[model samples]
Every structure is written in structure tokens, then in C-alpha cells.
Target: MSQLDTPRLPENASDLRSLYRAAEARAARLRVLVEAGQVLAGATPETLDAAVCEVARAAAHLAGYESGRVVEDRPGEAGDDNGLIFPLTSPGSDVTSPGALVLEGRRSAPSAEDREAVAVVCQLIGASLSARAREARLARLLGELLRGQEIERSRIAHELHDGVAQNAAALMRRLELASDGDPADLAKARDQARALVRELRRVIAGMRPPVLDDLGLVPALQHLAAEARASGMAIALEIAPDPGHRPPPAIETALFRIAQEALNNARAHAGPDVHVTLRLAYGAGRWRLSVRDDGCGFDPDAGRAAHDAGGLGLAYMRERIELLDGCLTITSAPGAGCSLLAEVPAA
Candidate 1:
């Protein structure tokens, strides 16, 4: 055998025992790291606390501590002991309030290897928690973005519906009353004015339906269904008797916008005679809105790839749902219809 492949015998029994213990400790450290990685991989804002506790338990087991716990080191908390206390700090952050990992009931000071292993676990947990915090911050920002956009849309829609559309209708009436003009010219002018008014109304609806703000979501959806039917699309709406007693304004707005986008996509992509169904149901303190269309659907994988290349519609739907701590799911396949579903808490 090659010299590098040959195993060397230890000089003494003590040396052999030392080598064995070293190998065991190394293996334990590797196992702890693997566990830590798994925990971090599954960590999210909702399950962060449980994941941290699992990491701490594993750290304690590997470091030979009787028990371990993770404590949030808020101001005015008790001081930490001299034992293994790994401070969980995010990189390049001046804010040190993240907290610490505490290992208790240690018979003696931890060895260097043990300290290193525990530190690795602490680092993983800290980074994962930090990422979750950043995610929450980003979600809040997106929520604010959606709220601002909706408010602006509502303002513009109100202006167009009340101000511009009324003026156009009045102008059309004036054109009809004119007595000195050629009949054909007057008629053409009146037709053009009427078309303008209709187009403005459509624009107003697209900006933000006033019914959505005046009445609740159900009435707004009913109005939407009527408009769709007027446009020769077979659209049906099924709303719950009580949609969780009407969610918060933001939730309502997001759901409405999501449905609006889904419908627009169906109209654009779904072939003629596409039958679309919009359903809203409330149960268990949550509301679900689904839009399904029996139209020629594209491959979902191809759609996702296109989205990744810069499709904002689907991305916006997901962002809105995520901001509300909810879920958005789209299922579609070639020759199959597409279904868009969004569920959010009532509150």
C-alpha cells in the first residue's frame, strides 16, 4: 500500500484513546453542523423560534451541556454566566439586541473544538433569523407600496368617473341640441362623443371601480361580473354569504386587484368563448379568492420562466399575498385552464 494510504499505529494506549476521542468529537461536530444547516434551511418568520430551539438543543448535545436555551437579550435582562454563551449577532450590524445561546449545567469549561462547533451553530441561527427579519421588513415595504398605489388609483378613478365622464356626456348632449350644423356631421360628432364617454368609463373602471369602495367586495364583484357579461364574456361570480365579515381594507384591496389582474390575463390569453368563474369563500378566520378560466392555457414552467425574465403581473400577485402573510397559487398546463387562488387571514 502507498505510504499515504497506510494507517499509523499510535505510540501508546493513551495516544490511541486521545486519537479516538478526537475523531468522535470531530464526527459529533459534523453531525451538529448538518443538523444546524437543516434547521436553518427550514427556518421562516413563523417557525423561527422553534427552529432556534432545535438548534440550541443540538448544540447542547454536541457540547456536552445538560440543557440549552436561546434567550432574547433585551435591555435590562439578567447577565449571562461565564459558561458557553454564544452571542447571536448579524454581520455588520451595530444593533446587538439579537440575543444569545445559553448552555447550562456544564461540568467543566468547553474544549476549543466544542466552542467552535457551538459558535458555528450560533452563527447559522443568527444569520437565518436576521434574514427573516429583513424579509419581514421588505414585506412591510411592499404592503405600503400596494396601499399607496391603490389610494392613487382610487383618486384617479373618482376624478375620471365623476369629472371627465360627466363633462363628455354633457358635451354629447350639446352636440345633439345643435340646430345649425349638418345632420350627418352632428350625428357623427355625437357618436364620437358618446364613444369617448364610454371609453372614459372603461378607463375609470380599470383604474379603480368606485363600487369596490362604496359597496363591499361582493357588490363590487357583482358589478364586475355584469361588466364582463356586457363585453360578451361568460363570467360567473360566487361569493360567500359572509366573507369573514369583510376583511381589512388592505386585504380587500389586494384581493380585488389580484382578481382584476387574473381576469385581464384570461381575457388577453384565453381564446374566444372562455368561461371564467370567480369565487370568494370565507372560513376559519380566512378568506380565499379563486379565478378559474376554461381557456387554452400555456405551460406553467414556460410562464414561470417568462415571469423570471420580467413579468410583473404574476410577481405582483405573489408579493401582495406574501405581504399579508398569505399564499398565492397558480395551476395551469398546456390545453388546460388556469386557476389563480389567493388566501389571506381575515384580520
Candidate 2:
């Protein structure tokens, strides 16, 4: 038969609808196979081709091939393998006949239509696979970066709490021991010592708020408000009683960082006299943090576009919230204001 006469493959609307059914069935089977292969891949953590094989078998089934198998081109199979094979069943028969329906283009002849279809399918599948791979890689990289940042912060916090703080206390004791001096000088020395202690505390708080570890999220948030007030920032923080509930550490951290970043953005870019508000509410077995600022707001979409060129603060905040299976919404308009809402399930 000619190339256009290659059995037509049922072109009627009813037949095409059935193709959807077939496609759904094929997708279900492929999902099962791929999921199973993923379990195996997780267990062994070394065999990628096997997982690809499992997925290919499903593709073959959907394409009406009788049987399919993945084969390697290498003699000893030391590297990646060749194309897939899907044997065809003879016409007017459900049973797969031997040595039929060959789709091996790299090693054998494949029809032009089949080749085009396969190329499109592979292109789509490849795009999906590449996206997934990139997500995994980015996750790993971000995890490493966060871990390193945490370590560095912890080190800096320790130095401030131990070395710098201790030296400030010693200076205070020495000031007390000094012979009589000008009252103004003594007053200035006392104020300078107190300022030094306050600066150290602020640094430690930034590294990791002590209340977060000791008191819980509420007190931690209160500390944030207190520090903001200390810095002359107009911050209004309101927290409903926890209702005797807590969130996972990761969720709490995510929310805290969201708040911190939002506040920082407001302070840095929103200009002075900016109004900041934070609210925490509980419902539907979840807790949400909402931050609003009446600053010189810009478009959220524009901010995202700007972020694509290496400005990662907002993106990082969104990533953290999403990693905890949460949703982040950013609403803003030029000269209107900015509002960020993040929700995470409570523990």
C-alpha cells in the first residue's frame, strides 16, 4: 500500500473519540508502570534506562503496537542504548505476530507518518522530562545554598553572642571601675555600651530569632514587630491566639521568611512612612500569613520579569512557601500597594 494508504487508522469522529479512550487507558497503564519504575529507581537509585523502558512500553501500548522492548546498541551495554522496538500484530488479528510492526528508525526503516508522530510525541515528552530534571537540579542547588547560609548565620550568631557580647560586658565592668570622670563622658560611655549590646542582639535576632526556637512562632513574630519598631519602621503585627495549634518547623520558617522578606522589601523600596501590617489566621486546618504594605507599589508581574534576570529574593520566598505544599499570592499595582498572602497547613 502507498504511504497515505497505510490503513488510515480509523479517522471518523466516533473512532477519534475512541482514540481518547484508548489514550486514557494507555496513560493509566503508563502511569502505573512509570510509578512502579520510580519506586524501583528510588530503591536502586542507579538505573535510568530501566525507568525509561517502563515508560516506553506504555507509549507502545498506546500506539496500538503488539509488543515492545528496549534494546541496547552497545556490545557489552556499558553506555546508553538505541531506539525502542514495537512489534505489530497482523491485520484482522489481536494476537501479535512475530517479527512485525518494527519502529526502529535508528536501526531500521520507519514510516514517515510514524516518524513525524513519534518526533512530536518525543519532543513533548522530552520537554516534560527536561523540565522535571531542571526542577530536581534546582531543588538540590537551593537546598545546598540554604544549608550553607544557615551554617554561616549560625556561626555569625555564635560570634556575636559569645565574643562581641562578652567584650561589651567586660567594658561595662571596666567603666564602673574607672576613677571619677566627667559626668558627660561617663554617660556617653554607658550609652555606647548599651548601643553595642543592642546591636549585637539585633544581629543575633536576624541570624535566628531566639523566640522561634524557645517560645514559638507567636513570640517570634512579636520579636519581629519589636525590632521593626526599634528601627523606627511603622509595623503593625497582629496574631490571633494559636488556638492551641502549631505548624511544622518548615512551614513556620517559610512563613517567617516570607514576612521578613516582605518587610525588608517595604523598608528598602517602599520609602519612609510606609505602613506595614501582618496578620495570622487559622481555618480549614491551615494557617495563613498575610502581609500588606501601603508603599509605592509596583506591578507584581513586572517584578517577576525583573526577577528572571537574577533577582531571586521574591522567587526564593515563593519557592520556600511552595516547598511546604503551600500557595503564595502576590497582589500589587503601581501606586496602589502590595499584598502577599501565603497559606500552609498546620501541624
Candidate 3:
């Protein structure tokens, strides 16, 4: 509640009535603010819209109105008087925003103090609405990420069934055939065993790179660069002066995945004879990983929109950083090289 000066003593009958009414309005406004605070405090993001209406009704009561109704001012359905409508701002809306609270006014109009009380409650409601919007967006992102994980799991299962399972069975058959003591069969069986090991390693690395677990991010990135170079892309790796502290395992994994996706995007879409650079930097208690490519680039907004609709590419990269409360930036334009930077504050 705001601090306000006390009312002066009335010197006449009309002045007394007016002063009493003013004092009563002030007291009612204080009560409304308290009730509105409690209502807003008790509200959850899921129930916030209803809670805003409750605050609006409380404001109406304070203004000496019999009843109030919260209404969204959609086109062609608003039948209420404009003067009685107190527009509630949405998370990022200006004046003329549609959501509002309407007092069922029949008697005298509300005073300035009463309107101010309404305004304060409306501001609180707006804040709560913003919170609700953020929570809802986060929930959606979590759901999409989970779905992406399930899809990845299915693909891995498919790979194992097709690659690993059949190769293992064939390797066993080769070993059984080699039991006959033929030197050629023995040599073939040994080669099959080595091929099986390599396949297993590839699959395991796809699931999670062993180097990432055994060494650290730098070594894992080196392995990644080696693999990328094997596919004809010139790669350069850079690391900042060591801050002598490694990011947590989760953060490290996120950084690696973001880099991986960025590299994959470049490999798929970037023009031929492209050179890609992966940079890792640590400074001021923050870790930054960036991937830049000297390949032909496209509009990031269009690419993001296309990938978002398909639930892949930059969308999932953004999801990984968002989960860690980090920032992901995509900088590119048509005919310009692309750069992606994912940065997280280190604790």
C-alpha cells in the first residue's frame, strides 16, 4: 500500500459527507490492494487468468460497484460501455490492448483513488500474465524436446537392429566357420571381428562419444573435427586461454551437441570448398562455443522457421541451450557466411 496523507477535518455538512465518502474510498482501496495481493500470490500460472478476474471483481467492489466481469475485448463481441472498461495489458502490449476488466457501473462513477487501485491491480495481473506465458512456452519446449529424444531413441534402435545386430550375427557365423582350421577362414573371421568392433564404436559414439567421457570437451571436439575432415571439409579448431576450470558434464554435453548440430548444418547446406571453424572460449565465468563456416549462407530466420516446422536443426540446438538458460545466436545472411554461438554462464 502506498503512503497517503490523512484527510483534513470537514468544516461544513456537505464537506463532511464528501470527506467521509473520500475516506471510505481510501480505506476500501487499501482493502482491495491487500485482497488483490493475496489473490495474485495464491494463483498458479495455470489459474492466473481466473485470478486476474477475481482481482478485477475486488477492484469493482472497492469502487462501490455491485459486480464486475473480466472480459477479453475481441472484435464484434464487446457490448460493454467503453468508459467502464479498464484494459489489462498483456505480456507485451501497449494501450488499446484487448484484455480488460469491466465494472458493472449503475450509480455514481468511481473516484481517482478507486481507478488508481484498479490500475495497480491491473499491473500486478499483467505481471502474472507474463509469468504464465513464459511458463507455458517452457512447458511446450520441454514437451518438444522430450519428443525429439524419443525420436532419437527410435532411430538408434533402428541402427542397432540394422547395423550392429546383423554384423554381430555374421561375425559369430564367421568365427564358427573359422573353427575348421582353414587359414583364409581364420583371416576373414579376424577381419569381421575388427569390423564389428568398429561398428560398435561408431554406434556407441553416436549415443555418446566415449572420448567426451574419457577425456573432456576439447578432446571430444578434436575427435569430431577429425571425423568431419574425413568427409572433405577443412576444419579449424580454436580454444581460448584455459580458465583452468571445465564446465559441468551436462554443460559440456550441451556444448558438444550444439557444436555437432551446427557443424552438421554447415556440412549439409554450406557450399563446396567450405572451411569451418569451431571455437571454444572461456572468460569472465562464461563459456562460449561458436561454429563459423565460410560457406554460402541463407537467411537464418527462414531456416529457423523451416527447421522449427520440421522440429529439427536450429530448433533443437536452441532447445539444448534454452534448457540450460544459455543463449544461442545465429548470424547469417544470404551470400554471407554463417556463424552460430552458444554461450552459458559458468557457476
Q: Each model's C-alpha lDDT?
A: 0.78, 0.63, 0.78
TM-score of 3: 0.72
Q: Tell me which of candidates 1 and 2 scores higher on lDDT.
A: 1
Give the per-residue lDDT of model 1 (tens digit) for 187-243. 766776776777777677767888888887877778888888888999989986555
Model 1 bad stretches (over 4 Å)? 1-121, 124-195, 242-244, 305-311
Model 2, 1-347: lDDT tens digits are: 78987876877999999889778755655564456445434532245445545545444544445433444322221211334443322233322232222232243333454444433333333333444455565776597467647756776778887767776877776587554776766776777687777877767788788889787777778888888888889988877645466677887777877787688778776767998998887789888899998988877776664422322367677767766778899888888788989988775
Better of 1 and 2 by TM-score: 2
Poorest lDDT segment (10 consecutive residues) of candidate 1: 74-83
Task: Provide the lDDT at 340 for model 1.
Answer: 89
Ranking by TM-score: 3, 2, 1
Clash pairs, candidate 2, are: 88-101
Model 3 lDDT per residue over 1-347, tens place? 33466656778999989888888778878888888888988998777778877887787777667677666653222324423666665545322334666677645567787778877777666666666666666786777778768867886899899998998899899889889898998999888888889988998897789999888888888899998998888999998765566689989999998887777778878889989999999987789999999888888877666534422467667767866888899999878989989999886
In candidate 3, the residue pairs with backbone N, CA or C atoms under 3 Å apart (3 or more residues apart, or in different chains) clash, namely none
Best by TM-score: 3
Candidate 1: give the clashing pairs: none
